[model samples]
Target: MSRTIPRTALLAALSLVTAAGATATVFGTSAGAATAGCKVEYQITNQWNNGFGANVIVTNTGDPVASWNVEWSYANGQQVTQGWNAAITQSGAAVSAKSLSYNGSLATGGSTSFGFNGSHDGTNAVPATFKLNGVTCNGATDPTTPPTTPPTTPPTTPPPTGGRADNPYAGAKVYVNPEWSAKAAAEPGGTRVSNQPTGVWLDRTAAIAGVNGGMGLRAHLDAALAQKGSGELVVQLVIYNLPGRDCSALASNGELGPTDIDKYKTQYIDPIAAILADPKYAGLRIVNTVELDSLPNLVTNVSGRPTATPNCDVMKANGNYVKGVGYALNKLGSIANVYNYLDAGHHGWLGWDDNFGASAEILKQAATAEGSTVANVQGFIVNTANFSALKEDHFSIDDSVGGTSVRQSKWVDWNRYTDELSYAQAMRTKLASLGFDSHIGMLIDTSRNGWGGAARPTAAGPLTTVDTYVNGGRYDRRIHLGNWCNQAGAGLGERPQAAPAAGIDAYVWMKPPGESDGASKEIPNNEGKGFDRMCDPTYTGNVRNGNSMSGALPNSPLAGQWFSAQFQELMKNAYPAL
Candidate 1:
């Protein structure tokens, strides 16, 4: 399934049983015409030193709260550092949390919850007052403060493994979405996995990605840990939700604003890091794919994205992109088992001079932000949620053809590179020049690079379509690299493997092949589901609707969910005969 959507239906079940062991503090219900049937329950999910993690479920017992807003005040000088599923603001002792766009409409008698990470002095007490809209609760309970402070032990940050034996992952283990797997199994041409895959996806789209996703991630880890025998447990997480995210596309927009860098760190990364850092999970190896479109949009921003908050420009100006990623790498990297890979745009992106050096500089800056060098990072990823061909089969970096000396083409730079393989090789060298260690390798998302069958390009030369020319295929399958939905004619690339090429560590199906990119236009279910017009077949044009998609897939499920047609097509067209 696409990494864009969360399995929300499983959120509640997952959250209730996560490793943090939450404690729900119930409040007395107020009954009156003026009160609005509002009752809130506060749960302290986790605490350590001066910081704490919490969950708040606000219940509307009386009437529907369309576009609801919840306001509360801190009692003992505790301040909310970051929050999710709620837009929280704190002024001294008072804190107010407004409902996010996705969770504002809570039905009567129904409840929705939000989560956060906060800090306090020696005394941290839960607030006694809560107001839904403007009405105060009848009998709200307050939490007690601890009398004594305990010394906090600093967690160990392991040095990078110098030998192959010290590496946590013996081989690359690709995560499979259990929910998507089941959906695929139920399809017409079903295939159920005999052994459960090692990784699981945690989405951070809108407010839902944080609130409901925690439980899902916990459950996935719990299950994987339970069955893990001699093999190391691997979990793949997508750190996707960024402000102005996918600015170039409409289907996978995020809830955050470009400038909310502090919030992004506190609200988004903290909670996820907390889960990973839990002592119980220390035995497992976790691979975090940080911020998919963050760096990439910046690359595109340098050319063509002449907007005020060109996704990358805004992130750079506010320093959120680097800061957020740095915080994640440092916080999660501090955990010996957790591996962080920053998203380096696909080969198609970094292939040009306009894009190359800039991406490497960003990587260096991020390392600086994390208070470390590039060598500390696990590596960078390419072709994430993209359909760029894995390798340029017939052409080398110096091959000359098609009116330009490979140097003048939009796909090649003056540096004499023409394909993704060359791009990654050159990318490794650039990063090394900037202080990345020689051992630092590259990873490719071999999920859907297999653009084969009738649409696979057969003939070469004078190939105007950049994808076909680079891919060594005559009929390029994707509408554009920007076309991220359930693409037509695109198939699964190579399965997970170690050391696919020199300087390349692994080939992974990072984007699960069969999952729908999003719902198609002319079909609708939920907000941001099915029918973005970008996925509409009738609208023949570039992903932004200016050119034609050569072999586009039909409208399908919500992004991240399964689409039977897309799955079958992928298996049918898989490269290396999956």
Candidate 2:
């Protein structure tokens, strides 16, 4: 009654078919003839870029030489765009493949192999109903043909059409950083150096006040309210400064000491609790307390630079800090969305297996110490300061090293950064296989990877293709856009028209725009110099120029501008209904 094929026959069928198609079978074995047995073996390998490669092995156990056919079905909105190795002929959701060239006469213990490449957005599964030489196989008395039905499409909702009714966050209130602002300033002519530090710091009160008092905050709330009908667009406040103000700061260079922990609780942790306690922003969803580490040494530093260790002790203490913070946030008893994520190094940096395992262990320990379980700790953020293969290679961790060793073989190459589609797809597959499928997500720094910063020197036409891949494709779901270094450049405008591919989610500006990296010590108008100038607009010249002239600094304001622009664009593309 059950329809099943033998494993050996399946492999032989697939192998013979693959060989006939000019594609090699990476892993598989042949079984006996298909007449006597009913076992099946198949694998989906090299899933990347909305496409995947598959290998199916089948065995025949009954009689002598005879022709055969294999059938299968796919779920989860999966569709076969193109295939190789075996001859694939599809009718709606039902796909059938056959061996054109048989491997001589099959004995009772013969086997065959077949495989092909496919494209899909959801789950992958094997189909039922197979036949050999017109004889219904798998011992099924009745082999009913699958029905032909067109794939279903997602629903479309219109944008906001009314008043406070249109406002997504009608009663919801949010706190903002008063210091936030964005703008570029003139620079003196010289060899410019980037002033953007490698880390982020936040003044809790200032951030909360800015959000509570500004029109920008209202705009964010409005946008969220608009999208509320679709799904919860929980407003998040990222407090990155912990232990140090910035990555390059002297204090940050030191390991996280007890003093750092104590100060963090008083200055940062307590204020967060106070904000959550307030009734106005009671419905707030604090998605994550992201610790943005800009320095390369944040993880494992081969350069021997000083790094902050977020070990078990620090994390445990921080857990108590968060628990206390959570208690305060729950004052309204309506704040149920607060969560935390430790910034894990980028894919290239974490490598694979051992390196990733070690970092994961540290995270697990920290989460446990925090008095929270791994479930409470959201996935790690994979980001980098410099968006290039050269910079990403500094921390490349792959699966090349044996499973028992710290290293494993390299699953991805940093050189693919320019290949946005390939890069995003590869990461999706790699992450899923590593158990981060559901929890892990990526935040891409759209600022520099496209045509800004160091990429300027290597610019080769617009990164429009890459943008489309990240924002207009199915693979963009796990990706969140961040303008890491936003002095100026291309890729800064609105989101494209087409909704991101099936799996792609919303886009947001992780990095606030306009903030300066620092002042130009060498060249004028460089990112470092731009950041410095923006921070203190009037302060001209370079670091050589003493910190004089005072107005609001650039970091906060510039960030606001970028954030506003990105949000608007997101509404345009993904949330037109909002």
Candidate 3:
């Protein structure tokens, strides 16, 4: 499993040192060119306990720069935990940010910006120096705003990676994916453009946070280690934000274009694998949910669902989705100490004939996509962030009891599986036949499916509606079973636990409950980004025969921001009761 990646592949990946421990700044050798036309501004946009976010805009006050690099230092012992947009790295107290290929060129008097989420001690002081292309800005001063410290809990030191092999995960500790929770924690709640007050519910959003593709993983790893004190650490990384991301969905659309598979490989996957291969993190157990919703959509509804797979037709037009995810599995699947769980759509989805075995077979193709065998794979993840029950206490995959027509029948779908557990076992069997290891396990997301209490039956009736009958015990009664916004009446599912069933390895909270699924279709956001129709209360796309309607879940913040009202609702309706 530890075979060397080709030299051509390792060339760039091996040199991507995106993070370094620095308490003090170490100046690097500068090219002696005079940089008179460059100017930069750093502003702290939002702050929370022990952390803050900053946006930096670079202006070419003079001539156009074919390329650019910005460097700064954090005084007062503040560490740049993680960042996005620009490729950021820290050495000692010094930090350097280079523009991505997309942001490298700036016309004269033009401006481009990048943002980052970072942490600081109680005393936050802006850097006194700024340099673009290694030349210092002339009239820059330290920011005057006082530093703030949000409420924080000290992290327990993470125990050795994976713990004892025989007792892997015996520490009973679930690692939070800080990659996301940290972002949600920073969202402002009041009625503001970036404010999403309900984000408080995601205080522990990531027992392990996912770091998306191409944003660089080194900084995230550094942040995770810093956040983990002296306890067992289980880190969850969601390898998402793919080019042509959310193929059909627009609300959670990603930055990379679908055609950029080359970038996805060299820039995204390679660098990600490099960071995870670090010797320092060898003792940390990492759970990698590879490309959430990427492959599954292509298998189930790429051409059919309008509300769910909005841009899928364009994606299918080009072959980026296939090449992109395949390369990801080939590279990341075989890493050491990394548990790669490929995302499989929830039960209701694969439960349909058009999906099941086809999805399983797709998983097989992806496992061996890049010259690697299925042995490169770990296992499969079912119901990732989707509101599907672990098991419908009322129905079975083979249950043929009720409903008028086959379309309205809950237990008459492909091979008759209605719950996540049965689907998972069946998938494991299918996967084994595809050459996966016998020990291959499945992860069921218990995040939002906890409709156990009153909402269990969720008014999903009228008997004629096959969806309602099949999903009778489900808390999610959205227009289409594919509705994935911040669902209404959703309660916390089973607490994070390992081995809940025969083929199921763990019940993880893959989706932080309070985070928004898409912007409220009501509010307007920035360009190249749009509100998910599913979040619109008035959305009517996923409905069938006026019976099922998509968008049952209301307006939400951007994909991962906190939703206050949703949090309250989740708490009010927690299943096992937190």
Most accurate candidate by TM-score: 1
On residues 1-578, what C-alpha lDDT tens digit does candidate 2 reach at each position?
A: 32434645443444343211211112112244333443333444334445554545455555665555666555445666443334578787767766545233445555555545566664443343444443434432212121111111133333222211111112222221112210110111100111111112342334433433332333333322322222323454455434433333221222234236565556555655555545654344444435545222333432232323444234344343333333222321233444343454444444434345555544444444433444443334444232222122112223122222112111232223322323443454454454543533333333223322222232222224433322232111211121122222222221111123322221223343333333222233211112334234343322211222322223333322323332222222221121
Give Cα distance to truth, residue 514, candidate 2, Å. 2.0
lDDT of 1 at 473: 42
Q: Residue 343 in candidate 2 has what lDDT?
A: 51
What lDDT does each candidate get?
0.60, 0.35, 0.59
Instruction: For candidate 3, report its TM-score.
Output: 0.62
Off by over 4 Å in 3: 1-172, 177-220, 226-232, 302-314, 400-415, 457-476, 522-528, 543-547
Output the better candidate (2/3) by lDDT: 3
Of the pair 1 and 3, which is ahead by TM-score? Answer: 1
Candidate 3 Cα deviation (angstroms), residue 5: 62
Off by over 4 Å in 2: 1-206, 209-232, 245-258, 277-286, 294-298, 302-335, 339-342, 347-357, 384-440, 452-505, 521-578
Task: Rank all candidate structures by their lDDT, best first, as comma-separated numbers.
Answer: 1, 3, 2
Q: Give per-residue CA lDDT, model 3, range 1-578, as digits (tens).
A: 12433434332332231122111111222245443556665655444567766656677665578888888887778777667667888888899988777568878666666666677777565565677786666453222221121112233324333332322233534443333333323332210112111111111112113333332345555544544445445566677756787765677666677787787778667777777888888766677777777676766556555434546766766767766767777787566677677888777667766677888887777677666566555677888767766666644444333534444453343434656788888888988987888777787888777765565564434454655556664444454555666777777677666666777767777776666777766455442456656667676654321334454456466766557677656655667764
What is the lDDT, from 0 to 100, of the residue 373 in candidate 3?
67
Q: After superposition, how far is residue 160 of candidate 2 from its true place, in Å?
A: 26
Tell me the TM-score of each prediction against the true structure.
0.63, 0.38, 0.62
Query: Better model by lDDT, 1 or 2?
Result: 1
